[model samples]
Target: MVRGKIEIKKIENRTSRQITFSKRRNGLFKKAHELSVLCDAQVAAIVFSQSGRLYEFSSSEMEKTIERYVKFSPDYFVPGRPQVELYLLELKKEMDIMVKKIDLLEVHQRKLMGQGLGSCSLAQLQGLETQIEKSLRIIRSRKAELYADQLLKLKEKERELLDQRRRLREEEIRETLVRPMLPVTLHTGKDETGSACRMSKHSSEVETDLFIGFPATRL
Candidate 1:
């Protein structure tokens, strides 16, 4: 006999809904059991009736299967104390590792600062000395490089200033040479009436002689 498909909707009658729920819930649990047996898998099913009755089935211990699910399921809310304890244990391990690393760093820092030397072995002291010497060499090399760069910059600045001063001096000399000279008048010896007379009508004809020899020789 061909059976027609039933339309899926909420049953209107309470008795009919109860009967349907009971039959479907039993079928679902049976299918879960079959799946677990056939595939050698863990399966669980939980249902609550309209009257608030709880029904559950599990391939193994119900608690163990649910705990496993919680551990593996990303969206599952873990309300169990055992899971919280496991998380605390993991957090403690990470904190212990971080604390150890911090202690090691503090010890190394103290050694570098030349403190707490009494606990260090001879080899450790020697290694620290070598590391310090290397660091000093790096620092001194960097400082020398900086000094050389500063000296080079100062020398360049001095050269620029000297060039600027020379340019200004040359410009001053050019301006002096380009300037016009003022006219100068000269008087000749007095005439027969003992009055001074001009040597020429214009200053251009006036002869101002120049002597370059010693004064005694000229006399």
Candidate 2:
């Protein structure tokens, strides 16, 4: 039969309570004895029943174990000192250290802003000046680099604009070169009967020669 897990509470029945206490007390003593023998450790356990029955177990003299514990404990420990007081003392020391660090940082900040010169030696002041000068140089160099980058972008944009203008001019020139020219025709006056007459011989000859390329140059 599987036994149910025992709930950790005060046993109500007197008979069951006594049985449980007796069983647990023996178990406790057995565990202490085993722990001492296996681990080579000193162990002590003491318990009292509600009816003033005493139960005790110890691997060595219990008084000697207790004396060793007290001896190894913190020197500042006392019989009535609360544990919270020790924590509070540690916190106060840490707060003092933090306060000192904050004060030091504030002084450094003032020095960086040129406000703590009164306490600085000549060499310290010179070092501070050098540091500031180096920082200024770095800042100025970075600023110049930024400006140069912007100038380069502007120059590139200018070159792009120039190239676009040149391409447009070339396109315009090509259009002009490819344009068709209109033919010119001369008007001759009509005769009295409103009928067209042949041009004068000289004029006809000149027109023929001009239009036909000098009769193909007989020579």
Candidate 3:
């Protein structure tokens, strides 16, 4: 017969209860073993009966198996492991703690998640808002200070470069003032006819003006 279903509340008959507990305990352990074998699970089961006796089974090292059942990811774990979700039942018992004693996130949750303290005053909101505003102000001030320092350093560098260019130009001007200057090209001289004409252009900037000094040919 399929005898898996049974009453859940207190058993009025002590002997019947004892018998049921033994039967169920054996069945439970058998099921645990079957599950471990069938699913290739590293499983552990621990039972403490009404008589305070312990019965346990582990498919692998009991500690390792149990630890695997309580793994946590990184993000939700603010200060420690996020495995506190595993302790939900325990946390529920201590739900009535003083507001100051809880975590900031928990308080934030209560405030935002509609699960926080029953009464929040306008003054409290004002205080929290004030802190937020102050934090923003401090951040902005620090950013401005950093920006000012960077701008000052950049301006200093720019000034240094400008001064270097100015010094180079002044040195060049001084060298030009001291060095021998190249002779300049002259305009064309007139022939006996007093006409200005283009001359034989040489590779040099120095030009020569030829006069037909005194006419060499006469008719």
Candidate 4:
């Protein structure tokens, strides 16, 4: 008679649970061994009992199988290689590139300082001379431009001084022309009472001895 399928649930009785665990674990190991031998496939199994007993079987070395699983499985944890390792590798590549560039720069600097002339061909020497001449020309041109700017500033200052002097001289001449002249006073004679008489003279008139006599004595 075909038996009904057993309900897949935990065995409640302690003794029955232990018996079922032993039988099922041995059967699983037997099937794994047969599959490995018949199909030439690697198989591994692990069982843990309620009493904390360990049971494990492997077609090959347990460590080797676990290592292979880690290599092929996407969810396995790998030691010694993490996200930080990728960053470190990229950093090392950049450092290598920088070192190469530094070496190249040092060589170029040595060539410029005339320390390694023996390795340079005639064409390279000519090129170096041309580059130096171009750099010198550029420097001299900049220097000349600075000198011209300074000379222009000095010329502007001199012109300002000349203009200031001219303005001061013109102001002086204007003040002189606008000034008023004062009249001259002269003592002409004494009166009969002994009081001296004075006369105002025009600034343009000439003095004469005829004006020195007393007015009463004069006609």
Runs in model 3 lying further than 4 Å from the true structure: 1-64, 67-120, 184-219
Total clashing pairs in model 1 = 0
- Models ranked on lDDT: 1, 2, 4, 3
TM-score comparison, 1 vs 3, better candidate: 1
Stretches off by above 4 angstroms in model 2 are 1-83, 183-219
Scored against the true structure, residue 87 in model 4 reaches a CA lDDT of 46
Error of 4 at 111 (Å): 3.2
lDDT of 2 by residue, 1-219 (tens): 999997899989999999999999999999999999999999988786765445678899865665566556776456776544555466467657666876887897799898968999999899888989999999999999999999999999999999999999999999999999988855566564433454455455553324544456543
- Provide TM-scores for the models: 0.48, 0.43, 0.37, 0.43
Q: Write the per-residue lDDT of candidate 1 for residues 1-219, one digit (tens) a residue.
A: 999999999899999999999999999999999999999999998786765455788999876786777788767555555774565476567657666876888999999999999999999999999999999999999999999999999999999999999999999999999999998755455574434434344555655778687644432
Clashes per candidate (backbone, < 3 Å) = 0, 0, 1, 0
Candidate 4 local lDDT, residue 200: 30
**Which of the numbered candidates is closest to the native, going by highest TM-score?**
1
Is 2 or 3 the stronger prediction by TM-score? 2
Q: Cα lDDT of model 4 overall?
A: 0.79
Cα deviation at 207, candidate 2, in Å, is: 34
Best by lDDT: 1
* Per-candidate local distance difference test: 0.82, 0.79, 0.70, 0.79
Instruction: Give lDDT tens digits, candidate 4, residues 39-138.
Output: 9999988675674445789999866676677668776555667534454466467657666876878898888878888989999999888888998999
lDDT of 3: 0.70
Error of 1 at 216 (Å): 57
Residue 123 in candidate 3, Cα distance off native in Å: 2.0
Candidate 1: lDDT over CA atoms?
Answer: 0.82
